[model samples]
Target: MVTSEKNIQMIMELADAFGPSGFEDDVLTVARKWAEGLGTIEEDHMRNLYIHRKENTGNKPVIMLDAHSDEVGFMIHSIKPNGTLRFVTLGRFANIAMSSADVLVRNALGEYIPGVIAAKPVHFMSESERAKGGVPEISSMVIDIGATSAEEAVNRFHIRIGEPGVPATKCRYDAENDVMFGKGFDCRIGCAAVIETLRRLEGMDLPCDVIGVLSSQEEVGERGCKVSVKHANPSIAFVFEGCPADDTFTEPYAIQTALKKGPMLRFMDVSVICSPRYQRYVLDLASEKGIAAQASVREGGGNNGAIINTALDGTPVVVAGVPTRYIHSMNCITSGYDFEETVKLAVATVTSMTPEQIAKF
Candidate 1:
């Protein structure tokens, strides 16, 4: 069977999970189920999930494979007298894209109640209010779940302050177009890649020990990776991410990340300058193996790669990403081709690595 068919369903489930930064329980649940028997599974208080490959020999150098298990979302800050919810963003979001967006609020009862990011209707806006261009700050916005008053929201809906919420979008695959539409692809796509890579390497005898980490709370400043890096101190690392695709809006010549082109190997983003030697090696390996891959120098954005790279006096790290369009929003799109290529590249990298080669990095 094709690799895509084997793992795409798990990818969809990861994308649909209700995890947002500090609240990564649901995401870990899905990951653990898919990773069962792949290795020894372990989790920390911070909810970081680690799978130590059964083939590992403690004497060998560790190869850390990472993918965060959180998505951009919101947290309820307060309940207004009108029963609307005032909230704060758990991670960054384009405020303009938030108005009237569908959301699922996790009330105190652990129930995800349906709601919308309420926006002021055009007809209700005064002339001066309308004069202000663009959307209001997210702090001023509220989520409405149809409660008549604060008491009703508290008693009937069981809504409480500090609850988490996520975009209310379902994941769907377009087989004809080879595209996927969903939320939380930012790192969920990466999570699937890490799992599939481990599965492919199950019986292989490599020179290095492999540890796959589905880290948590990445969107809130790479908190989970900071912890997992200490646990899996390795000589090298690969961070799989669902990176923002630039093809649709960027100038043709300036575009480095594009869908269906392949997985992107970024030299550097705002966070870290990746180990140049290792990055070049991976790129060269991709060329030699005929795996579809792209390279980019991002002006903005960051990932767990930055954290792992600097940890333990530095480790050579590369960020391989699926070109996901509309990341950090309610909906995102990625190609099935990109995902497959990523898995192949990851497998090749592991199989080709040796103690001598890692020492060179």
Candidate 2:
């Protein structure tokens, strides 16, 4: 088992890496380095990394644990006639929070340039405009890189259309409350869980080969998972992810799930409906083991449910997620306790699967 301190360090490191949709190379590099001494690691054509452990006889069907390596970010659409830069959203983002926020712009050569979202001062707005409230539209936002003119901006930064911009910051811990806040925890936490679980299972001689996929392009769609599943051809799969929840202000009992309670066993979502039998099996295991868990019926589509359910003509799929608060923003928060417990649950589920159990499904 990975020590608590080691797990925390992994989470922080994964969260600190920069990986927006279609630009996951940096994060993938870090993951590859971490998997070097662990086991045999392979990267598919889609750039999804599959880390595995040697299989044992009498093992169940191949089980895959999928986690996305992408996060929400922006792409430079054009360099304006002036020195300002105009960009479009690469993923879902709130314009209100984006305006005037510090951002990191990556050029074609992978250079990090500091910039900020520039907006009209509130004092210059009319009272009626102020009454209407909210920041201006995304199209009105401009990226300021401290250049004087268009010529000077082009000369110094070489800013071009289609560059990627991400939030500029690092993950930090709230020592007083033990809360860790940073960007990309939405699914990087999931990636860290899969990596750590495989590390924990080292030399266990487990049945059936287990594939850990650090999937890409999940924010735009489950594009990477579709290709990875076709290649792995696993008969059963589990997707490790972080689910959005607001339990601190909302009543925990009334809410769908709460942080630090353990993994949330999702029953259904828009992308894919979980297999009833597999869902029951996971829940039963959690109950028998007295592992903290909850059920979630998310309103929107998410996780690897879309591809995993349809892989290999049909694969039984389950999604285990850590409850994350304030997802898709500059700072997403989750519980360290839930993260550790989710890893435990995934390792147990994979190890407990048997050939008979898979065939019965």
Candidate 3:
């Protein structure tokens, strides 16, 4: 079983791995290593990871767990005549946040080289350019590794076209406040939660079979999970996420996903509307068990749940979201207590269920 120390380490290692959409080999390495004792691991060309619980029995209903592995990143598009590199975003990025952000470029040799996203300095900008600015166009940005010419970048740095990169932020845990600062919490934190959940359920005998899926390329439109759903073939799915927190920007009365509020159970997101019966069941269960939780009707977000819910003759799905601040940026914030409570609520949901109750959904 994974202990507290091990879980913390796993979360950090996952956050540190540079996995950008199509290049998820490094993140898969971390997940595959930690999922060693769970069961046999399986994958396809898309790198969608899956594991059946060790205690599963063939006759029970299947309960699938999903957490995406890839994080938003950049890909080298071209090399300039000067030493700087031209790039394109691999997934969603707040364009304004790119310039000056610390980055690690995976060179042609597969080694991560430190670099910084660069743009024209203010002093060098024309009066006309200065008048039309609000973070320059994404296409105008470059990654500078202190090279003097394009030839230097290719020969000395081994930088090339098509290589992917991620932010260079490292995971940091604050024990006193239980707040964790890191990169890729959007789904890496969810990935950690799924693995830890599997560990917690190591030998438990329930009326259902459980499996965890760490899908690839989620940031690029849930591409990996569209394939994972066919593989897991679950009767139900619990999609976990490091969901964006609204507390900071939202009005007090409208804050639906707040940090340290256990986890958010979505009623609806752009991707899917949760199964009403299953959603209510989990909400009631959380309240009865005294688990901290929040519910929301999201206007602009989607997840693996949408794909899984509609797959394989219609599977019921729920999302257990860990509220994260500033997702898709170079850094993010989440709370350890929120992760613990999210796991607790899920464990209770799994153990307290039966085939009869599930049929209601």
What is the lDDT ranking, best to worst? Answer: 1, 3, 2
- As for lDDT, the candidate ahead, 1 or 3, is 1
Compared with the true structure, what per-residue lDDT tens digits does model 1 show for residues 1-361? 1346658799999999999998999999999999998989999999999999999988999999999999999999999999999999988999887998999999988999999999788788888778886477888889999999999999999999999999999999988888899999999999999999999999889999999999999999999999999998888999999999999999999999999988999999999998999999999999999999999999999999999988787899999999999999998999788999999999999998998998898
Across residues 50-97, which tens digit of lDDT does each residue of candidate 3 receive? 888989886788888899999999999999999898999987888777
lDDT agreement with native, every candidate? 0.93, 0.80, 0.89
Top TM-score hit: 1
State the displacement of the C-alpha of residue 110, model 2, in Å, after optimal TM-score superposition: 1.6
Spell out the clash pairs found in candidate 2.
none
Write model 2 residue lDDT over 1-361, tens digit each, in one string.
Answer: 2237767778888887778888888888888877666667888766788886654232446788889988888888777767888888767877776878778888766788999988778888888768868488888888888877777667788777888888775788664555678888878889989888888887777657788889988888888888889877788888888778658787656677687678888788888788889888988898888777888777775777668898676899989888888777777788678887888888888879877888777
For model 3, state the Cα shift of residue 188 in Å: 0.7
Q: Which candidate ranks first by lDDT, i.e. highest?
A: 1
Mark the regions of model 3 whose C-alpha exceeds 4 Å error after superposition.
1-3, 128-134
Give TM per candidate: 0.98, 0.93, 0.96
lDDT (C-alpha) at residue 45 in model 3: 96
- Comparing 1 with 2 on lDDT, the higher-scoring candidate is 1
Model 1's lDDT to the true fold?
A: 0.93
